[model samples]
Target: MEKFEFTKPELEETEGILNHLRDTINDTLKPDDELRLREQLMKAIEEGHIQRDVFGLNPVLQALRTAQIAVDEIGLKRDGVLATLLFPLVINGHQTVDDIENKFGTSVAHIIQGLVKIHNLYEKNPIIESENFRNLLISFSEDMRVILIMIADRVNLMRQIRDTEATEAKKEVSEEASYLYAPLAHKLGLYQLKSELEDLSLKYLEHDAYYMIKDALNATKTSRDAYIKSFIGPIEEHLTAAGLKFHMKGRTKSIHSIWQKMKKQKCNFEGIYDLFAIRIILDAPVEKEKMQCWQAYSIVTDMYQPNPKRLRDWLSVPKSNGYESLHITVLGPENKWVEVQIRTNRMDEIAEHGLAAHWRYKGIKSEGGIDEWLANIRSALENNDDLQLMDQFKMDLYEDEVYVFTPKGDLLKFPKGATILDFAYHIHSNIGNTCVGGKINGKAVSLREQLHSGDTVEILTQSNQKPKQDWLNIVKSSKAKAKIRLALKETRAKDGLYAKELLERRFKNKKIEIEESLMSHVIKKLGYKETSDFYKDIAEERLDTNTVIERYVELRDHDSGVRQAESAENFEYESPNEQFTRKNDDVLVIDRNLKGIDYKLAQCCHPIYGDDVFGFVTVSGGITIHRRNCPNAPELRKRFGYRIVKAKWDGKGSSQYAITLRIIGNDDIGIVSNISNIISKEDKLTMRSINIDSHDGLFSGNVVLMIDDNSKLDALIKKLRTVKGVKQIIRI
Candidate 1:
């Protein structure tokens, strides 16, 4: 590689950036370290360790600009800035890990290594989708600082790509930024970077929409400023009179945000009313911060009519990523809604200058989920459980959350809609497995009770209690749901083993050598679709031991032709080759090889022909066929897992399934008659029942139909959806 000469402008720009970087990190960068940084960087540049991007931008200048962004914007210190500046050399293979570790400290080297690893993964321009998203998190989730640097570089790239001619490449980069980087920025509390990334992404992807919103804001700037002034004037005076020191400013919402509102509400740009917000940052001591913020909030609300639902109180409990503020919306001048944010200067610094600054501050050891997740990562790294780490990251990345308290007043946070069972599992898996119920604020509540913020709960546990399949539906947190599923699997395995032992004992007691294939044939003869199903029934003592053994002997002897010859006419052997039929005499072609097994269709979800279906063996009622996507399938599979089996319709038969459809539509005169007419006109379809209810000009009804196959049902549904007055129709 040939080394390129530095132009005069490049050197001048480098000199300015070097001065800025040194001043920013002056306290931490010693004299010797500063000299080493300048020397090593110049050496790398001279060694041809850099190349210009496709836009033909200078790599050294770009690296310096990225470092400046990290320091000035993200509040990254000496190590962070140095790693950002030196990462390019490693990427170009001019600098090795050992060299970096020796030149800088271990921290800088580790950071650069993470950066290089991510760069290698990004060489193919991979956008992290569902298949690869978890891998991204597990590999780099522990290196959050590295991810932040990557985000900063992406922000710079998006900024510089505006006039570039790489159309397709730019679009791919923009989509990746929107899908991954912007969301990570929001999660990390980088509001400024998050907004910039989003706006730029919109600018590239939806160019016309972005400029439209931007131009609209510019057009209304004069009137909007006047409105903001009118709203803030009295509030500023009121705050000064109350002896509070504060500065107030107003800003319009981001263009991307405005675009999202337009799409979400199905409205035009003019329909957006709350386009701007006023923020009041108070200068107060650490101890008096919350008090002063609340006082300002009161003063603002006293002057304006505040919307109760729009209030968000984060001062009481800060966000997981260390965001603290009180936000409220109120009706300002011209009866227009305006958002107000209240926070102290310290809080504003954390929100603006850096998200990690608050946690890195001297006295703060708390960053609720980050700290917990970091600990989880350390253990996961040791155990090498990539999937578990993925689950852990997913659990913590939920944006909307609910915070609750234990009896000891320890605050715990969970995803919104989390139940008391989730709380118990979060406390401990053993406690969750044995949790019977809980007491919320001195009132006894079931485990299914949804938790609310600030509610103190005490879990009640019993020794005999165990996790049930229904618990999966009760808990909303991923952790609790995962634990319940694992426990159910383990329980099923243990039961299967115990049942195997018991059956072996019975066979030994009878002095009968067990024949594996013959026993399997006997199990199917008893209508068990799975070998485990047979063992499960025997283990639960649902089947009589003597009766099962005698049947096995009869089937075995009959198979050998001795019992068949003894009584050819009166032989009671239930042949395994018997065709499937219901006791009600509804003949269906179920298993092709079977001749006389009793089975019935599940009424909950009618298993029609050409539909995906499965079989579940019943205790005394033989086999029950059900649709694979049946509403009750998850619970049945979780609890009675061993009883589940695979079943398919071998061919069409003389059987009709009763299916129900719930229809909602306009309560027009005789609208129900139209729906009935459509169903009646279809060939081989019969309306079994029609229950209709009408109110407030809308009608909802359940109509039962007898159909032979899924295709007919689907055709009927499509025809019903086309009805004039029908709004929606779905099968139940």
Candidate 2:
């Protein structure tokens, strides 16, 4: 390949750039590294190319320069390699020189975010993911720079491949370019890169097919030129006569596209006359360009019959990526179907360059409008779940889009097939969660209903509605799903808390001394969102008091014996030898008083002794001890607070304790009677609770029992949570 020779003026510009680079590097680099960088630059100049792209990222070479110097002098962190990638942005600064650093910082922050997104690709390939827009949004949320850098890298690599060795390696790169990178380039509005990527992808993936197409074109070179001339003659004459300034050029579609057309439609070469399209570049104001193009279109249709269905009015509704061109297939001289695309120069540039070119020319707004394109990048950064974040990028940022509308006529672009739930969420998360119904074009609709282009949706939401777990199955957008899941989890927590509070009040009213932590544990066990919610459930008879007491007793039986202190002096904890006794009435009596320490039951695992137990002291929420059998106990032990308390059931006499038992048995007429009779006769307690439910030939009965502490409760639970013919028994 021939090297590009720099003209005198260009060389002067290059010299200025070099001087700027020198000054910036001098200021930014350490003294020792500066000398080494100069040497590297001198060597690079001698070799030509300067080891830099147009953007001047000579990172690997710079690293060598940096490493040759003492690390302490430069004081660069290993991960700070991202800074090198951001250097190009520094030179193009606005206002104060501080703006340089600020933009540099912003760009570096975005680049680091992009790197994080790129790391996500290792977990799942975004191209193959179902939710392209979600994935795209996730990527964008991290940093739009990631997508831009990826585009730049891929383009540079393609150019390199075209002029380098290792054909097989190029082919692999080309295949990836075709399948993933090219489409991305197209979406980004990088027209030149998009075409080059497509051509390169085709060059390798279907070498034989590409060569055949090339050969066909070469063979028809004379006739092809003649055909285009003949075809454009009338249109040109009419436009010239009308005093319109327009440029027309014939463009053959890429080899890959032709191959795809043949494969997809099962057509031969001759059948694809419209494979080569003529582009009419109108020289006019942006507003008048489309009108002039349409008038030209009318003339062309009049001159030759056009395929009406094949005509695409992109000027009216541009692609989400900002590709705008009017396409129409018209009959040619030999009755051949010829395609024509009409657009203004601006539209053409946008069609080629996507969002980057727009940003370069128009500049992004402060609030970051739709054109900002980095909104998705920010979201990816905010996401902590690696897999989900990656998935979000693939779905929201990378996918093809459908432009819909709000009832008020605002354009809402969403991934294709976005559900109404997604639409609601796109408007706002609160709207999505409370959305019980929606309407497309004034028709009431289900939340799961898929949306289409031009659909004007009105979401109907209830003020008091809460998110349901079932919504996770139907909501399309990951944003909506994530939000719903979060809301549901929160609601359950609040409900659990409410239930706990209600149980505590009941204990107080009954003059029954209750462990505050134990009560909280019971509420958490019930999956309530808060202590208040737990109380509400209890007040509404959704929670039984006896079951709560039995659960507390069981928790005492297993975990009442010990507490442990942390070795870290900063972390204050009680020694495991310390013991706390609670009466059956629920009053906590510490046998060994420990200073600045309190214990409570963890709601996560309402620690019933038979269930397994552990204690955690929350700073203000109080100490929460969970049953060892409690699902959350293990997790609470691992993270956050780790204070545990030694406790025992030292309550005197036959103290009645509440315990809930689930009985699963064969559905029968006398099941309730038999269970009630046993409870009434075998125990000294009356029926405090009885709930019978039958499903799939199984009768599951919940029975609340009053027993003498944990030992008797455990024996009864052993008989209940695991009754004969019982599929499963669980303490509620």
Candidate 3:
């Protein structure tokens, strides 16, 4: 409404800027705004303050150099902005700039140079780790100007790339900029850069969809613009009529935002109606910003029907990322839903640029400073050794953020995909290792359960319990994943050693000599890829002691065939259960003869006479028998479990007993024939269902038979072992 004017020094700087920007750049600054900025600059200079280099160089001096360079590089068209932005870096750091220029050629600008430096620095330590380091980098900022310039440089590139012929390449650049730079810009409160980068990037990455929506939007633009103008006119009129100083502006949604709505709602372009929005900026004191916003909302809704469900009150508390605005969707004229965002201009700037814009506009507030977030990002970059920092950063920036609560109600934010386990681990490694379970909002939940916002979680821990291997499946944080992996590995190593000691103690108690050489063979025979695996399996109760000992014996014998005879000396079973053997008796006498010379069950199978039996000579406990289908059969076949010695019944008659066959049936009739078919197929032994009374036609029977030893029993039982109804064969 006023004519543009500037002070002497301000006009001088303006002329220099205009000389460079006149033909090339579109000046978005209104005439009045330009004169105001120039006047402010001159006033600040007169008041003995000057814009300084990031290193504190006087702005007047920097401007002078920048002006000269812009004049020298005036003919450079495509990357003119870039060159102007770079002049400072070239002059300030000659050698460094020369090296970069040599490597990338002179075409690269100072802003690009700064970007490359920051990029390389971030690339070097890409993971956002220890927030401390990031804070240290920022808090020690000599001038903070370099970082600001670098950010501006990226924004300019984002804009410049859009106008280039390499549209596809620029699209990729924009996407990356959005993922990394835009968030950074927003985090820093650089709203101008943030909005432009987001809109431009969204345009290229999703062009067709963007334009389709854009066209649909354009079709309604005229009517919608008029409608919004008419809708807001009364509010402006009412505020003006009330003598309240305020600024009202239209807020259009970004393309990326519109596309997200279409994707989320599964809607066509035509389905989207509320594309146009409004923002009400008020001239008010900091304390009155909220009150005025509410007053404005009252004015808006009073004139038009408002959707209660679409009302969002963010003025009470801003986002952790520093976004604040009050949003309301109103049913405007023609029954169309029109959204409005209400904030102070300060709030609007912060919403758009984030922390960077805050720095430019209001400086940093001590309570919510940029150092805090930057420190977090830095910490993530540093502590993440398992992942490349770039990869972690890419994931870190793109991931949706979740907010959890500390025990004291303070917020603990994590990536969206993080789980309770991650939350526990994030608190402390000791807390994580001891964490057994957790309560989400006073309700007990699994550690693997995904966490959500507003969840007040309390981790349950066991003082003695360690992390379980299954935690690997559910943990999502890079830190948690790495810590859990380390803990599991360390625990497994300890368990393996414990298992080895246990086996050693068991052998020592029995006076069984298994040399370390033969021990390795036993470990390998257990199908363990590593000795540690074998030991851990034993400690975990996954491997049986008998199998290990027996394997050791077999390997010992194989290594030296001469040891075959010595097997008898090593094979001694001093069972605490058996007391029938008399003192000084070399072998127990059964039915008047030494039982050692008579029929015996093989210990490998522990088979009874009626069982699919096998027998082996025990070095001390006479002879032991086992079922032919025993788990030890494979090893026995290879070593001595199957070393069946032939013997006959002492003619003292038959030892009629029970031989149990585990029958697993489909709960159907004639399940016995299904079982008996195999027994009948064997033709060597007769089996009767001791338990099955043939009721309901589904029978699970145990066949009983008297036999000499395991001679033909193995073959007969092997055949029965294959029966359709027979799930397992155990000699009882």
Candidate 4:
């Protein structure tokens, strides 16, 4: 760990931060609360707890700065401030939650506990696969205050590390701040803090881009200010003439945002317009906030041509995070498009600091919706099978909201790009679990169909249509993805148990006693990651029970040494289905090999005329041909090594073999008709049987065909692949 020594100037700065923290929390605290517990927190940190962090910064000072950010910058209350101060003590085990709760209160203690859980989960590098990171994200979300404090803490860390010598640590912190916390801050409506975090993160993570944008901003500072003055002067005059009480100002966009626009637009800094936005904060009554905002909007548009496409009306329906603003882009002087944001003073505070400030207002906080969204996030993290889901979930934190209607005309908000399946889950989990498809605007649509704004969606479901594994790919909402995974996991478990029972019955029919350890080895050798996965494949009919039983019997007999060989060069041993041999010619070309050896192609693998084949010497002095990847290949090669012989296709290969091919596609008459037509068109290809079953709009079937040579087989497979909606076609 890199250590930072406390110097004179650093100590002076720490004192100032400490005083600022105390002053910010004084108004929120009771008369005796801060004087009593504040001293206790600092003393505990000094005497029992860690005096310095991994970076050797003074613990008390860092806590004060973190607390100051939470209280002053984030607009968190006394509990949030105190929890930020007390977290270091609890995380270090010097103070317990009970002790803090007795002195500070339940809210403070709860927040402190949450903070400790998160702080303990923090590592220099965190892998999303680990349960720790998943828990870390989900735990803090139960309380929105916790997420705010965490963002504040991250901002404090990012701000403090710029001059530190810990380059690698700085980069990790910067990356997390940029990728994770910035989105979170934006979601919570802390735009000022969010932009600051993004700017600092870019400075550390992408040094060149950060500096280039900054330098270009500095280079154009004079002209940008002049243009802003010219633009704002007219808006200020028009709004005042209309007697709208408002103060207007122009602020440049953050360096990070500017860089993003440059990259997105594929241009240099100068090539990008609208590098800054104008804000008009109105001093208006609560009831007239919207009326005055529009009045001011009309005043501005009267002077400047408003770009109707760029207008965003959030005044009527504020964001879930309590963000209220009217955003529009108007054509100002010089044919330039300038963005303008208009909101009330109260709206401005809520916009800048989020619902934390809205908590003080009457009927302004949208905690219920934000709470439900966070609950969905928490649910998604539990049993998260994919680490990429966490990244997607984080990006989902601030996704643009899409407003759509249900069949009953109820309006619902979803993340943009959410599909019909996601809407089903959004309504109810049972609906989502059994969802097959939907009707959009009274038209039939698949579950994968993306919902558009203003469309009426009525989810179509069936009790028999449970969530399939592919449902995970169809939904865009985190709630839908998480619920699908849970459903699939439960279904897999049930199938695994049922398959185990079936396997036991088959084992009994074979009269084989299954040893637990030996069965484990068998499943491992069969290439299963987990025992459940082995049984699941059986339940899904991906594996044959007869194949498994044969494997078990082979393993049992091998352990008993019933097929022991004296030597590879002289021994001739035979198992039930395999034979042994002595050395012969290096290759077996079927008809040309030995001229007197009779051979039979193995029925297990159904080796065709043109297959990459091999030969096994039989007890009757004949060879059994088998394909290389035959199910029994491993056992044959392992036990009867001396009998193995190299074989390959030769000459015209006019012989025919019966092959079974499994085909699956959409359940359409034309699809099946086209496949049948193609097979009948090919000469020398006879379709013996076509067995198909249709269910849930999909058709799956197997066709046994007598086909000559692998060339013909390859051609048939290619033609079948070209069939529209045919998902898969493979020979069995």
**What TM-score goes with each of the models?**
0.56, 0.41, 0.42, 0.57
> In model 4, which regions exceed 4 Å deviation?
1-15, 27-32, 35-48, 123-125, 128-133, 360-629, 632-732
lDDT by residue for model 1 (1-732), tens: 555666898889889998998886677664687788778777877777767777767777888888888767766677778888888888878788789889788878988888887877777646543434445665465565677788888898889899989888799889888867877676667789989999999999999999999899999999999998989999989999999998999978999989997874457899888899999999999999988999999999999999875688989988666779999999988889899999988898778744555645443332232344334324333432343333333344444677778899898888877888999999999999999999887778898787866578899999988788778868888899999999887777777899888877887898877788888888887778987777777767655454466557766777878732333433232233332222232334585366678787776677787888778766444787878777767755654544556677876645677888999986655678888889889988899999877644567889988888899989899998988668898778
Model 2 C-alpha lDDT per residue in residues 1-732, reported as the tens digit of each score: 233344575557545644544443344434444354345335434555344443333433333332222112212222233333333232222122244235334544555555445545634653333234356556655545555555556665665455545666566667667766666555455667677777777776677888888787788778888899999989999888877888999987877778776664456677566668898888888668778888878878888889764678878876556668888888888778888888887777666656444543453322233334444323324553433433333354332566678878898777666788888888888898789889887778888787765567899999998787667766667887788888877887777676666666766775668767765676676577666665555655655565466456546555767444455543643333333222222333322343464654343333433333444554343555556455554444444333444344333434454667777766644667766765676565656888776644457667777665456565655654343345666765
The stretch of ten residues in a row with the least summed lDDT in candidate 4 is 363-372
Candidate 1 segments exceeding 4 Å error? 1-8, 130-135, 138-143, 359-526, 529-732
Q: Supply the TM-score for candidate 2.
A: 0.41
Q: TM-score of the candidate numbered 3?
A: 0.42
Better of 1 and 2 by TM-score: 1
In model 4, residue pairs whose N, Cα or C atoms come closer than 3 Å (at least 3 residues apart or on different chains), thus clashing, are none
Error of 3 at 620 (Å): 19
lDDT order of candidates, top first: 4, 1, 2, 3
lDDT of 4 by residue, 179-256 (tens): 678877776677888999999999988989999888988999999999999999877877887888888888889999
Minimal lDDT window, size 10, model 3:
70-79
Q: lDDT of each structure?
A: 0.77, 0.59, 0.59, 0.77
Q: Number of the top candidate by TM-score?
A: 4
Residue 703 of model 1, lDDT score: 95
